[model samples]
Target: MSSEATIRRGVRNSRYAAIPNHVFEDSRLSMEARWLLSYLLSKPDNWTVVIGDIIKKGNCGRDKARGMIAELVKFGYAEREQQRADGKFGSSVLVIFDEPRDSHAAEIVGETSGVAFLPQTDLPATVSPSPVPPSPVKSAHSNNLDSANTDCQKEREGARAGSEESDTSVVEDRKRIERDFKAWYRTWPTSLNDSEQAARDAWAALTPEERAACIERTPTFISAVKAIKGKFTFSSVYLKGKAWEKLDDPKSEVALPTVHNPFSRAWMAGMLAILLRPPLTANMPAPTKFQLGQIAQGGDEADAVRIDRLQKYGWPRVNTMHQRAFDRQGVTVPPPLVAISEGFEQVHRDADLAKRWKRAFERRGWPWLPNTGHEWFFFPAGEPDEALAKFSEATARERGDDDAA
Candidate 1:
């Protein structure tokens, strides 16, 4: 398992040591802070300890140890002491865990007993090559005086450090709030459409200050309202105005001017025209002027592919070829001819050709014939000769020619 995962698992399994009174002054103990407290209380005071030494002993990264120590100090679980430059014993505040049997608890007991019993592991070795006489016993009062001085100095240093950190955190919080404000401002929209009620509802949930910032940064809400109204007009009307009416509120509605403006009308109409244009499908190719002319002249047998290609390549002359053929053959071309001609027109505008073909089919005694929009033009059910004769006369009239009797 990864080292982080191992540490997390260890933390979960271990019981939390009771928080010290000093630590409770600051609210909340993070997991790392609690871990540091436990690790500190588990050991005797002496081990030549430092932040780096703790990292190596704990099997944690140096940066992680540093962060943990900072958090411990922030929550008052640990305190730092200042060492004197002379290498003599410096001021140090012993961190007292709330546990009854804590290392610091032993130290407190020792102070009252008038005998400081240093942990065996922390004591320096007494070394001598030859027998040496023992020194006279020092006064217990003097020892207590030294320890108290060191503890007081450590407490003062810790308090000063805590104050500095608190100031820095306050600044960081203010900056974070400012960043959130800017982000909210940039995303707020001035207008909403009929289908955007959910989005508006979400926006309304923001605080008044946030909403004001959004309105200031976005375009005027009136303009947005007008644009939405214009774009949704057809769809709203199709539903008998129910869609637009749903957005109205008797209490909160914003009043708009009633004056008609030509510029606004023109702009709205232009937008509508663009919106209503047929979308080009993946399979459809753009038509050329030549292809359009071929569709106009060729009765039915026109080559739609050839006309499509000629139009795509911007060659209008190719359409004149089909028109010339139509002129020479006259209007009464066979059904095969009419089919091809209709197909050419269908490539550019299927809806227009479908309507024309449906009308022609109905004019004949083929009202029951099924039509597939614009895919094919149906021939009436009858003898081939009779159908052909009727088609020829119709074609001649359609082409403004008199060849068909």
Candidate 2:
């Protein structure tokens, strides 16, 4: 029979539902299957075509086109009508089943005969008997099929087991390396800070693998240590070099200059205190005569002197003079510096009388006569009382304001 005739006969006897919407929802379907379905549905009969034509028109590989055809059949959307050519040279034709077979057959028959065949609603739901129990020989064949399925399952399980074991080993190795590296980094700094002999003692304790891992994971170790300590202050050249190397970008060609034996903030503070002397007797020695003159000026020049001293001594005081000068010409010092100086002046003023009294007593003899009853009061008696009272009043006011806030 012709491909179309065979399809029509099959449709007449076939009892199957229309293709479900969920089947085509899969994203894996190739572009060919989508086009093929739409093209076949447009025609009334299942058209036969060479598989090669499908591949060419679909713009896909032959294997891909074949896979798409197989998918459509598996999903109940299409069927293949295969034919064996009898000593013919021509390619075998493929008939695609487009619409639900029963529906198409009913429509075709109704159109040809001019009679509509209404589906029977009152017909009993018939359930066909399960296929006859397998014969003894067929039963043996079924057992062989089961054994084959079991073997295939076992092979798949073994492959999965091998993969899982490798993955577990990798995970354990990673965890162990991480633990060892953390412990090593914590102890590594001690060795770097120690004497040559002490460092050798510590280095000898570490394993070769641990040393390699430490080098590899230095950046991570530095970051973790910084987080735990809140800040990292390198005190020596060796520590600085190690830190820089750990944080350095490997892709860059230029090498950074190394810093050695970093200066302390305390050292800077002492140097600054010496450079910017107040009008006090127990003052630190000035670094230069110009700095001394600047300190004597007691305004912007005084601040400049202080800042210069601080910076020279390695303290990082923010340079506000440039910004201040930009905003308002002739304004040499910033407002923050002015505020700080004002606070200092207030403190000095509060202690002025006590300071004067103490100095006076030290230089000159006691003011009270030796025979007078006041000689028993050895320390400065009434001089600091007013200043102390004012200080207490100011402190109370400040506390009250803070509490209100």
lDDT of 2 by residue, 1-405 (tens): 211111111221123433323223333345567566554444322222334334545767657767876765654555544443475432222334433334554354345443234454656335342242111111111111111112221221222223666446545544554465445545545544545433332332233443465456555655544433434443232232344343333221112212211111111112112222222223334558877887888897886666445443321221222222233312222111222222222112225653564444223222211121111111212343443344334333222221110
For residue 66, what is the lDDT in candidate 1?
Answer: 65
Question: How would you encode candidate 1's per-residue C-alpha lDDT over 1-405 as one tens digit per residue?
Answer: 111100110111113433333332222556665666666654333212334334544668767876876665554445454333366543332332322234664454455444234343544334322232111111211111112112211221222223666445445533553465445434434223333333333332333344454445334333434433433232213122223222232121222212211112211112112212222234346556766777677764245544334333322222222243333321222222223223121111245544554444333322222222323323323343454455454344223311111
Q: Give the winner by lDDT.
A: 2
The positional error of residue 358 in candidate 2, measured at the CA in angstroms, is: 88
Query: lDDT at 185 for candidate 2?
Result: 44
Candidate 2 at residue 213, lDDT? 51
Give candidate 1 misplaced runs (Cα > 4 Å).
Answer: 1-293, 296-405
Clashing pairs in 1: 91-150, 288-311, 300-337, 300-338, 300-340, 300-341, 301-337, 301-341
Candidate 2's C-alpha runs over 4 A off are 1-31, 44-46, 84-93, 99-405
Q: Which window of ten consecutive residues has the lowest lDDT sum in model 1? A: 1-10
